[model samples]
Target: MTSDPQQDWQRWHERRTAQVSAPHGPLSLTGTYWLADHPDGHIPGVPGVWREEGDAVVLTATTEDGITVDGKPLTGDVRLGADHTPIPESRVATGDRRLVVLRREGLWAVRDFDPEAPTRHVFTGIEATPYDPRWVLPGTFRPYEEPHSVRVENADGRERGLGLSGELAFMLEGAEHTLQVAVEADGSLWAVFADATSGHGSYRFRFLRPAAPAADGSVTVDFNRALLPPCAFAAHFICPLPPPGNTLPFAVAAGERNVLAG
Candidate 1:
């Protein structure tokens, strides 16, 4: 560790603070209305009546509903597929609030994000400890003999299957720890993990994604960029739990620690 990691850490911390407090950041989320919970298609404060019909959502709206579809007042009915784009590009909107249609395990839900939300108003910043290069260590990616899925409980207490593509192993303290990771579409790694500090200092769990590994399975297992999941910002999101044995026994004091006042 260098003598003045504070300067670099300050810069990184400032960036994180700006990100979480941004116009449509995590704190902007106000509600998550699951279609399963409302079979009749009425989600309070949200315009349009929605129903899950097969693989798509059947939305019925009148101009009086005060709903905007594709930036124009909507009337009549429309079928909407899953919203996979960023929140800004979602098909539904009401002023600054982005209504995103979601599909998970065939179950549909809608997420509402508003810049004027109370959480966003009270958001300080993400509390993160300084970055230390020593915490960023080289690692090895070992692909699973075969990809597998495990039934894990989500933040909303729903058990759903979480797909695991491979495992990344690295030495944190003295013992080697392995984290089940997913290979994203861009070939990068994605991991959800917890440490001793979880539930005590920061979110109950955080996310980490070291850069893509080499062909030979060499990679950097940097924990300095660990992130809080969306569920940490709002209770409506159904974020999956860590896979079996994904938790580290040691306290990881790096990366984003808590939500601070920006």
Candidate 2:
């Protein structure tokens, strides 16, 4: 890889903007309907009858409903598991809108992603700070004796378990800082965090993803790539909030500030 941080950051920023503005991206999400809320299987503006059955969602539609399954017209009931594919490839669709099934902590929900959503059309771009070498610092990852989960409020006002596998420690302005991090399946480290800038100069909270630690537990804690949570782009996403100890006491004047005003 090239050693030019500025060039790399510009490419990353461009890719991030393209991804966010793409059809079926976070901006396209319109609604997240929990199956339990509508026991009668009649979603407010959705055309199909949807109900939870065992571990799958059963959707029933008629030809008049004009719903499609795997690109074919859906005329009868079909059992669908949670969609693991991208939004555009979701199994169910109504016109240009994709219907995505989601299961979280045993609760099932359906998401509507429309390519022509108003939010997607109105998106200007993400507002991010220029790459600064000062924000990139050496860090150490210390794994916990045992992974744990903490209860935290989600963007949707629900409390759920947020899992943590370790802590990333680094120094900023001669002060030591730490953030609880989750170990992803790909060996990356994910952190949900907030700082003094949060809810003030920046979004309420942001996400940090660092590469997996080295064999010696050394890592680079780069704040220049801080990300706006998915909820920042759409109101329907249920992103988790920062955990108790992940809030930094000082302002972090780096990374993404917010989505550009439309």
Candidate 3:
């Protein structure tokens, strides 16, 4: 665990690059179809007929649809309870495309991913700043008196509820800053923010996830891994915008700056 930080950072960067370029990665996302938008449950170019079925999405298909469920051709009807399984194990497919069922805030949706997406074909690489220890600093997590939710705009120009469980407060340049944070299922702290650099030198908004808080409700707020939201990769993702008070007055000069196109 004791290797050069620069080398570790380089490896992390390499891994991030590989992850983004992998099949069904961010670039492969072609569409995120909300069920409410398509009452017929037929997503454009997606095989089969999907309809909401009480806490699940029901699929009806035929061999001519060329759809597969668990590597077997699908026909008739199969009640899918939202691809609760990992993406790799999602039950519906067409050729190399994965049809992932989803439920968000009680609304159902489907995500379509194809390895041959145009975005994936033309992607150059993610432009990331080299990691510096200074960009990583200690911070404290203070939970709210009670959980609160705020309506924030999404990358898709839609407003949705962004849940907040606490605040991560830290000092970057002799100035204390705070960001509303969500406690991930895995216990990590995730923040969505924007700054002076946004919309000019960097993506309009980015995400930062500090490591999980320690027993003392403290954590390390690392901006080196700040990320462009998935919508930055494709236009279909509904990534949430920054919550209130999460925008630091100071510029954050680290992490992926912008999308690089060929």
Candidate 4:
């Protein structure tokens, strides 16, 4: 690894911009159609009839409607489970658009991803502060006695469960702070947080993903790698808000601030 933190941060920022502006990235999301809101199985701008049946979503489409499933034209009904694959690999397609099925808290929704989405077409870049070493600090992870779930509001204005597995404690500006975090599948710790810069000098909230703690629970809290949540790029994403106690009282002037003006 490079000893220069600024170099590393620049590389990270470059990769983030590439990912965000990719054809099937968050910027490509054009719509999130909740099945319950359309009882008749008809979604605006979508060609198929989608209905929630038990634990799966059934999509009925005829070839004349021009919908394809798994790369072949669809002429009958298909039962689709949640789209666990990547956006480009989603089974349902209409020309260059992908239909991703998802379930959250027993609610079924279909997300439409189009390569030609206006947001993606006009994406400028991410606004961020140059990396400063001062934002890096030593930390310790303390796992909860048991996993806990908290009810939090999502970006879409709905409440949902936010699972937390541990607390990350660190010292900044001579005071100790703690943030609730979730353990990702890869063992990293993910935290949603907002500081004094939120909604003023920075995005309303940002995410910090720290490497897994060592055997002694030692880790690094690096705010220079903070990220804008998915909702910052697209309105259709239902990203969860920062959980209680995760908000820092100080201004975090590093990392990404917002999407650059397009």
Candidate 5:
């Protein structure tokens, strides 16, 4: 732990604000075009003809389309897999707009990120409570014997498989609560959760990512560091909602509340 936890939180919050307000951040996301929905390979606003192949998306475009791949003008066909780089550095670009190829649950989709998106322009800041020591609680992570998947409804109103790795148990306001969590590749824990404040005082749902647990499974569950999900910044994000049992019964008046717009 830092000697000055409040100062550390202030720095973290500032960094998060800069990240979300970046040119190609979540606020700049304009749309997610599922390839299956547009069989003709033509998405309404996105250039190029996109068709899903065995494991890649074949993009057919011409000089008139003004699409570039890896900084070179693409005049023919190019096969692209899911983009793993930052949106601004994605392989496909039509001017300042990035066309990110994404594959989820064997379904192919394209995300359009435009720096000039209206949502980005209107984003003022994130509404967050000041760092409070009381919001920091000791927690424990219990890994499942085997990981499991649950079908959860996403912000886009689509059902998708949400992978769960374990349970994160913590205490709040004299009550014990547990949330289903997903373990990241680096061993950190991520959770999607909501409280009584959701939709009224905060966003509908928020994300909490605790650092890797200790050898004894001890960790810090800091609500002061809670984050508004991507869907809070843009409607196009398909952020999964809080799963059953993940919602807390009491209000959590900490962390990020919502996005402030002009």
Candidate 6:
């Protein structure tokens, strides 16, 4: 971390804008078709027969359907696993659209990322507040004996398990506060939270990803970098809502507020 937090924030904000407006970015997502919802194997607006078979998704298409697998035109059935690669490098694509296979909690789905999506074209930029030093606070992470999952409503109105690994405690306005956080594979901490400003001055909810804590459990809880979740850009996303007690009583007037409109 550099001593000039404003410069660092400006760079982060620029990178975030570029990424979200990219060809295959969240704004470009047109749909997330769950195979279980389409029993007949036909996904709306997507040309292919998709079915879940054990651990892989079976996609049957023809060259006439204009679908390609691994950059080659497809003419037969191809089993695909969850796409972990970047959207541009997905194994399935058709023209300028990428079909990303997704698996979560034993259910399978496919996301359609079209470069020509209307949302991507109309996106102006993100509405973010300028860096403020007050939003940066000292915090601590207290890990649990064993991680647990909590059922939370998603942006798509579905319920899903939100795994929680610990709590991040910090002080603001002379009061102590805490939020339930999940431990990422990379040792970072993630939180889905909201505040008084949410749905008023900012998006409905936001995400906070803090770096790994030190041996003493000390970390920086910087609201200056709070982010608008993917759902803020596209309705197809199923971002999890804030869990119980994750909502702060006060307003947070920092970080990315919303997607700028044209």
Cα RMSD, model 4:
1.0
Candidate 1 off by > 4 Å: 1-12
lDDT, each prediction: 0.84, 0.94, 0.86, 0.93, 0.95, 0.95
lDDT of 2 by residue, 130-152 (tens): 99999999999999999999999
Model 2, backbone clash pairs (residues 3+ apart or across chains), number: 0
Model 5, 91-168: lDDT tens per residue?
999999999999999999999999999999999999999999999999999999999999999999999999999999
Query: Candidate 2 versus the native: TM-score?
Result: 0.97
Model 5, residue 98: what's the lDDT?
A: 96
Model 5 misplacement above 4 A: none
Poorest lDDT segment (10 consecutive residues) of candidate 3: 81-90
Give the poorly placed runs of model 6, Cα more than 4 Å off.
none
Cα deviation in Å at residue 253, candidate 5?
Answer: 0.5
What local lDDT score does residue 152 receive in model 3, on the 0 to 100 scale?
Answer: 91
Task: Residues 144-187, candidate 1: write the lDDT tens digits.
Answer: 99988999999989899988999999986677889999888888
Q: List the residue pairs that clash in candidate 4.
A: none
Clashing pairs in 1: 124-261, 124-262, 125-260, 125-262
- Indicate the TM-score of model 6: 0.98
TM per candidate comes to 0.93, 0.97, 0.96, 0.98, 0.98, 0.98
Q: Which parts of model 4 have CA positions greater than 4 angstroms off?
A: none
lDDT of 2 at 114: 87
Evaluated at residue 175, the lDDT of candidate 6 is 91
Question: Across residues 1-262, which tens digit of lDDT does each residue of candidate 3 receive?
Answer: 3478778777877898888778988888898899899998787888888899887788899879998888998879988877777565678889888999888888899999899999998999989888878998889999999988899988888788999999999887787888889999999998999988888789889998888999999898888888888888888888998887877787788888887889
Candidate 2 residues lying further than 4 Å off, grouped into runs, are: none
Q: Tell me how many residue pairs clash in candidate 4.
A: 0
Task: Score residue 201 of candidate 6 by CA lDDT.
Answer: 89
Model 1 whole-model lDDT (C-alpha atoms)? 0.84
